[model samples]
Target: MQIKSVFIVEDDPSLQSLYEKILSYYGYTILGVARNGEEAVKMFVDFQLKPDIIIMDHRLPVKDGIEASKEILIYEKKAKILFASADKTIKDAALSIGITRFIEKPFDISVLIENIKELIDVKI
Candidate 1:
């Protein structure tokens, strides 16, 4: 099986490093990283082969996850984005925009890994 790829949109450096370490250990390729939502959208647009999943944080500078996900969906209607944020309020909104999943902040890293694996295993 081809290794799954992930694009991370997180502003916190520590969390970014943690995620890269854990996900890489699990055999997922880190496609790239984005510090904010606008960069996330731009990177998605520029990638020749889009990542299999996007780990998005809602409260981002420039655009926010919901907005960035919307913009991304316009370009790739079937984009699989997993909203990972502290904000619970945006869950419905993110789902409405076609995000594949939503996981609240401070979740277990194992859960996050499982979610990513589930997204990759399931046919879109």
Candidate 2:
């Protein structure tokens, strides 16, 4: 199977860097990073080749992750989006829209990595 690319939509710079590093180490391409929901939505919409997966954060400026996820899925129904967030309340709402999965904030890096791998299998 081809290597998968991942788009990160987190507002925290440190977390973004960490995810980028770990994903790169694991052989997944880092498609791009968006600092907020609005940017994430725009990046997904504008990209010629959509990333294989999206790592999204719930709290954000301009737009929340839930809305952004909704918008992206509207365009690409099968896109795998991992909604990683500290806000657990959005879990049900996010899952309702067909996000691949949710990984809670302050999560073990191993857990996140495992989820990404699982999504990759699904994609394949």
- Residues 70-96, candidate 1: write the lDDT tens digits: 999999988889899888987888898
CA lDDT of 53 in candidate 2? 90
Candidate 2 residue pairs that clash? none
The alpha-carbon lDDT assigned to residue 119 of candidate 2 equals: 89
Give the root-mean-square deviation of each candidate in angstroms. 0.8, 1.3
Best by TM-score: 1
- What are the runs in model 2 whose C-alpha is more than 4 Å off? none
- Clashes in model 1: which pairs? none
Q: What 10-residue stretch in candidate 2 is worst by lDDT?
A: 115-124
| Model 1 stretches with alpha carbons more than 4 Å out | none
